[model samples]
Target: MEIDSYFIGQLASEEKMKEINPVLSNVKVNDSNQLQFFIEVNNGLDIPADYEKYFKNQVIRCFESNLNSSEWDDLSNKGRYFRDDQFLKFAKNKLFIFKVDVNDSLIGTRLNVTKNSLIVKEKPKNISSNNEKTLTTIPIFRDFNVNKFEKNILDSKSIGSYEYLQEIRSPYIVCGEYLYGEFKNFEKLNDGWHVEYEDQIKKIPIDFNKYKDDILITEHALYLDENFLYDTLIEQGLEKLGTIITKENKIYVKEIDNTTNDFIEEIISEHEFLSTYKSNLKAKNLVYDSKQIINFHTSIKTRKLVILSGPSGTGKTQLVFNYAESLGINNSKSQFNLIPVKPSWTEDSDLIGYLDTINNIYRPSETGLIDTLIEANNNTDNIYVICFDEMNLAKVEHYFSQFLSVLELQGNERKLSLYNKEFIGRVFNADRYPPEIPIRDNVFFVGTINQDESSNSIPDKVLDRCNLIELVTPENYIELWSKSISNSLYKNELKQENKVETVTRSMLNEWGDWHGENVLNNKEIEIIKQLSNLFNSTFTIGFRTLNHINSYLANLPKNQELDREEAFDLQIAQKITPKIRGNSEELEKVFDEENGIFKILSKYQFKISNQILRRKKKELDIYGYTY
Candidate 1:
């Protein structure tokens, strides 16, 4: 066998190896050309006192010049040395292997060697220097083309080596399969990388020189950095961001992953009819205080429902229309929608909206009033109103409960349940659902009520929600009737001939003067007493009827205006006295002869008992003793 290296200890003698050798004496090379051998360094002897020193001093040697290629291979085989490529790669420049005792525990005492077995020593530390020093170094990489794998690794922005990753509880270096970093600032951060989609991670440095914008910030507005390591990133970005937020606690962000488009048109249609209103006539001079004007404004501003309850021919509907028209004049921006409420409207949707039978579309009728108001106010800031003519003929609570609740709902928009299948029979169908109506601040509601046997009684809740205004018919109905007839081009088309002859304008005005001048200011009781006593012999008046008459008379024209003057004579008036009744013999004699008008005038006129009674009798007989 060829010996290619020198040994520190002399080979054990043949006599010594015969007793302590632990392996077979004959050995051969394997396919890798490596040999196995054993020898007795000590023959039944205790370890040497300098055994540790001897082990440290041990070395292997090679004689390259003395051997041919085959001879060298043979020597390598005899030495049992194997070429390890992986070990060579790891030990390429800075790493080396030095044979040391496997049990050695000292760290820096370890030695290093090269392929040629050359030993190198570390420099000694100087003891005299006392300078304070800090050594900071970042790992540097030689130029290496980044492959797809490496690109992905960096994109992940991981924080440790591959081997170091397994030992760590979380493999941060390969976090989402990216290389790791411990960058102190954004400039040191990895760039020149692309992601599959968009990358949300952003970096902002904290140094003052790089910060161009405002750098002092609060903790509330911004948060998070590329790696989500600390809150410093949030503080820094917020410093640079410029925005004014007046309301406190108003800034935030959220990840909305699953967004969808829902119903949209119904929402738009529900808020289309917003409006504002004002009175046709304001009494600025009628009252000294602003309370009346305040009341007027408040009446228009806060109106939800109004009920004008009065007798027929009091111009109730006309007044409501006038109010609505007045609002049109003031609010020229848009016209208020006017809807006439019929007595037959019983269901809620009848006034709101319903699916049209002919066209299969949602149509708004009377209930359309509310829908129109909601639509007018849709998604905007404006005012609106809905006037209901003859609102109380139908049950107010039955039709208006939903409307009242909708009015009270606080949101700018009110979502109506139009398509709920459960509300099938009660209202509209599933085909048409009214979208939420953006609530407008200025939607006024007005209603008119005629107090008649055909009209329904108004509920107290409805009354509480309304401003009640009373109106009465004019006392001179004949004048109004005659004027209406005179203006009519259809006078010959009258269905009733007797309707023309029932009351004449001249007769009514002449009869109206009989009530005395300034009848409007007279007390109701005084008018009733005088009217009943004066007409006791002919027509009589009741308390309730007198009240009605007084209300009518109050609005009558006090001073008459005529285009032409008519002929008239001195008025002869009659009044009954108790003396006329007590003098029965005189009464009989007055009745026996053909009593002239002066005789009747004396019998009835009490202030002048001797006045001509026969003339009064004829006058009374012709006029039928009118009160």
Candidate 2:
């Protein structure tokens, strides 16, 4: 996952290919000025005899082919992210691999060999000045590997806020889009200029361990699971196949390193967590489907805060309490703290605490929520689940404002300010309760809101930060209850296999490029865009919701119990559909069968969300407002 896994190259026409390097005269181009991976042809023997099967995703992009005298141009835009003189001297080959950014329309990461990727090969020439001018044949097929090259490949400092880009670039990988200064780091190191960010994003935390020898626990560290690098080397006939993954896999961010997140993902995804959680729920006489458990887990990972809404007695609160227990977090005072929100609460002090300045003491809420946050900071390695029962009893925006603002800050910066910094020494338990309690990454905040007249409505800001899931009441409640009772006949009968274990903070952070191809492919992204447009007019939300949906999709179990499409269908239901609210008269056109909500629901194969909406439309008709 180094940044140099990609190279910035231009898509050439057949004629353009002939003009730059006539040795590839027989090569054909797919389309003009398109970006892709490619291969070269020389003497009708660029590839192995049976190359088609392996090289289907690659096209041919020589220096030039169809260029007229007036159309003279460089086949690759190598000047974009690098200094021409510096890059030319150190670059081993034109084919070097690089990493892809989350928001990259420009840079591509090394992954699958799907449709067409640009395969690049240089027509080899020996040093002619006082040296032999040996003609080197081209590689018919080549793959990519980030570990093929060493770090500080450019041997320079980063030019801007995307400073980490300088460290991950390597000389011997085929990083395709990197020539674009992003693909390339376009700013010259010596020039000392910085690129402006398109969005007003706060500068990302520096990857402090970029050069460290140790594989420290950090989100900035990249891991690539694809074998593109090995395949590329074989295609070029550069390496004998490796029978077993040895030091190579460990040194690179390849799979064998067995990252903590990878281990957690494998464990949960392989039915260890799923089966245990489902069993625990049933054993507790709770009736819920696998989809609900999956959605709940995905929501917890998508954002630390999860809002559960339903009519009374739908098991919203029980799910949170039971799921934590399945993970063996039975300690109510520490890792599991349930603070029942009082209905009359109206301010931040009601939830977090108060200054009590007259006595120069911080009186934390009796609920002990602050104590859990303090505990979270001390035990950063373990998870802390804090649930606000009846969270909607009071307006969430009032009591939870501090958390709403601070959770937006990432890593160690997320802190809840209790009082003035000067009061730390004056507070009763300065050592035990620091003035500012850091909301460590391991802390999970769950809220249960019973959707009755007693509860308050959640504002868009709260909805923006949290994934609000409205629990679907089972159609046949009596039957479900009977089944659950039968299933729980013996409390000790449930098998102890696949017992839930403590999940770490790393599992939450390393969900992997929500915006990139690794998580959701081009087809899925297209579907999201279509849905986004439809929701724009009626169900307005910001970029956070989109990203949460992607993360949720990325974290779905790899087991056949749930597919990506089905998980995404639930996400549209859980994340977007819950926000729909208005008078039935006003929303009638928006949910009309021909177009709008119903049309969008049917357009994509969102069967589950659509089913939920069917009841929603009916409820809106009878009750006038449905959420």
Candidate 3:
């Protein structure tokens, strides 16, 4: 019977209940302790004449002592109510709104961002009425390379010269977060930026350092530091906030968010990699199977190294490249790198760049792999892809040995050795080229391998380290080919109406924890052990291999059209069988149709694995080999 929440509405009498359409007059806790509204409705859309007056009266009552602890929590957590904590004064006559559902329950639209900023440091109400009219706000807009704006317009010293400065009516201009400066009679103010008012401002004691770059003509830079803005919690969504933004559309970060209208990442898509794959199918005419695409994504998440191995002209390389294009990074070289691994690449130097011992300057590789990794480490929020096309052209085990070892480790422990210990202190430009680069989780490596005569065999060490997926030809290949060929890749088409969600560095880091403390369930563990024992006679399955299989299962998107048995069947074919490809003679006993892997697989009702074993046995008999 306890009422812990209130909805603004006209309190109806028992006699007048039929007149109100879904008029919620009371709230009560049901037997389950869930809040339930008591509504009285007629079959009409028409609202009563005194509805607003009654609603406003109830709102006033709710705002007073009637609001319980749960309602206050809802106000802050669910973004349902405007906060009076900061210096946000609404216009006296501005009408407050109650966004409600059909049952008249309050609907919280703004989430995680509606709260007032605690760190913005309240600006002075003392700026006077005259100055408020002449005040304006601006973001760190210099990142845009506008012609005159870059070279001359923002030149603080030459501010009085440009007619654009004269057009500015605001005397006091706010720039980046809470920092503001007076725009008095030309001559821009960079150092004298202040966080007005005493409460939040005095504690932080922030100043502007004119976030400058080499592109400007003069030594003076007219920009504010982004870090400073972030440090003040302005970068975080404290929407309806004036500290970072309240001027333009009343949101945070005017430049990036407003331009593209990119909302929260989760709002776009939960399964970003799979979502982007489907988007590329229609938008770019890609013909890779959805299951294959899903497997590829799960592989990437489970193991940072994904090897796309198959016959030539099977879109092995195209799949990797298309992923970058689908991420809206087709033109961004920093985030997308396609390195054509050469036959001559015996060592890692050709890809990671060797330290010039003579000059002490670290010369990074031209392939952009090292640079992309470095950028990934710095910008952990972004996702970086490095595709080694025809990776098996050279011996993969030799060139990729460093990454193979490093990928086994996690977080900061995964550093790639670049220089000798003696030269570490002496290495010049160490800032740009550290002694060893941290192979962060943000960068995922994909290698395309064609199992042709020209390519060398991928060793057990390499196989154990990566998720090896052989590309399967699409069932409707001819139809998909015709569709793709007819659709021009270059010509303009309708822009993607839906904002495609991109998988980021944070998502990559979070994959390990997606499952419980133990990645594999007891049943899964027992089956993998049985399978490993079956293959133990030939080649021992290491923890790394077991971990890969378990991770793939753990990271697979829910409702993925794959049952555990079906997926495990694929994993065995992918993770286990590929290791002993050419050496079918060694595994001849275990590969028996009636009594070996098939018997164990059939016992578990893994029909797919049983079928695949039959196919592999056929391949062994006819082609004298299997992978």
Candidate 4:
């Protein structure tokens, strides 16, 4: 049922006449009036002359016109005109013929006529005489039994005695050396049983003798039925074990000795600390779950840098402490370390390490915390984060500028080693690991900032590298606080726990281009004035706070559609004006109706501390009633 053969052949022409007439160019006329022009076809040449009419006249019109021309006048006189010949002359000076046949019958012929000419096919051989022979002659297995027909080996015409007689109808006979056959009538000697034939079948059994070492047994192999393997394993109830698959598809069953907490710790350690922070908050009911974004470490997979910031008394420190405890570090691991940062500690040596006075040992302080972070990680691949609380209390640019550069060197060869042991000029001589270690992909830096009276602004350079997420004060904070406190302590609990959870990075992003945007509104106008006063008193905050407020509100859902004008006004009103109210004379002199609200807001500078307000409270109270 396969393709026995496939090819092409000439299709017969129905036209009458030897020479093709100008009017009937497709017609061929021979001298005897037998008309036959070559027609191209595929498969066997079964196409008859009657099928020629099926070809449209338009198809042969070009050839027809050529025949009547002077150049083709001789061709017009030929017995038949063949498009195949013309096509052949137009192509290569040769043609291709694919002759195909099935069991000696001319099933088909494919003729690819080209420029010159070609032989279509070889004439088939006559094999009928060979078919008459009833003997096997293949040589590889040597299975032929030649002595089956000894009686047929007559006295007159016989080949060698060793050769069997193979019937042949041809007049010629093959030489004994060239002839092929089996010994006929050999089966008669063995009681009509062919011993050689039976031996050939025995030789065909499966061969496994070549493989010895890898074979487990020499016995019969167990053949598996359709579902035998599945059924056998299911009966043993192996599927009941509480096992989970690893990435490679290896199943690990839960073990009481290992405990769930152990696996949880592994999973936690593998994740960057900042990413875990967001998730931890949600789990602790501190923040909404939607804000939990997974942020992993870049090159240092073992470290995390989280910067937490909010207004004063927002409970950032407490939350961070809780976070540390939840990691089981506060009790179980001495590895957990907290270091307080001061605004005055201004140098890279302050954070990295510095030589101490007593014996000139490069003693570790906050810098020791950094050293501990590097030392504590059991696996270099795990992250170890240093949480810098109130990071902006000191100008980050002032204190950490050099440290930042060293960190940026990341995977480079920057080394820090101890100096002399006796003088106050050396790191510990304990050969305590080399310094300036490559900052791992897992180590992290988390800083907390209080966006209140005593902080400097975080620089844009710092923000660009961090994934800052704002912790927005949950809407349910009051309810949660109430539940956590007695009725007498409700007010204090609410005040202490209340906070706005928002990330500084996202806040800055929302401002777009605040410096180029428009003027401030009442709310923004007010906030700006307050911040200005606070800055003037202690040199604590600067224009940066104003910008930060603008940035923060810009991202809030409530602040959507805030054009440039609205954004500027909102920053001034909500963040700037309130701080200025602490000064009574300044407030009254500038904001009094006689001076005009917009004018005072635009030009006044009552920048001073909140303590000034208490001293002027009486004057402010009197002035307020007059207004």
For TM-score, the strongest prediction is: 3
Taking every candidate in turn, the Cα RMSD to the unseen true structure, in Å, is 50.7, 19.2, 20.5, 36.4
Using all chains and alpha carbons, the TM-scores for the candidates as numbered come to 0.27, 0.54, 0.55, 0.32
lDDT of 4: 0.35
Residue-level lDDT for 245 in candidate 4: 20
| TM value for model 2 | 0.54
Stretches of model 3 off by over 4 angstroms after superposition: 1-267, 271-273, 483-494, 497-503, 507-516, 582-585, 603-612, 622-627
Model 1: per-residue Cα lDDT over 142-198, one tens digit each:
112223224433455422111100011111111221222322222111221122222
RMSD of 1: 50.7
lDDT score, candidate 2: 0.53
Flag the better candidate by lDDT, 1 or 2: 2
TM-score computed on alpha carbons, candidate 3: 0.55
Per-candidate Cα lDDT values, in order, are 0.33, 0.53, 0.53, 0.35
Please report, as a residue range, the 10-residue window in candidate 1 with the lowest summed lDDT.
Answer: 562-571
Q: For model 3, how does the per-residue alpha-carbon lDDT over 1-627 read when each residue is reduced to its tens digit? A: 111111112212333333333453333334553332322211011122223233321211112121222223334344423343210232111111112222232662111111110011112232122211121222222211222222222332221111112123222332222323223432322211212221221111123433322111111112122233343424332222333211122223445655666555542233444444555654556577666787777787764589998899888888877776666565578898889999999988887888898898888878888778888888988878888999999998888878889988987899988777678678878888888888776777899998789999888888888888879787666776676567553232225424444656665555445643456777667767787787777788887787788778887765443445557767887887676555468768778766577656642345435555677778888988776
Model 3 per-residue lDDT at 68: 20
Q: Model 4: which ten-residue window has the lowest total lDDT?
A: 195-204
TM-score of 1: 0.27
- Report the lDDT tens digits of candidate 2 across residue range 409-502: 7777888888789776677767776778888768888999987899898987788788778787555556766865764533543444245565
Residue 208 alpha-carbon offset, candidate 4, angstroms: 48
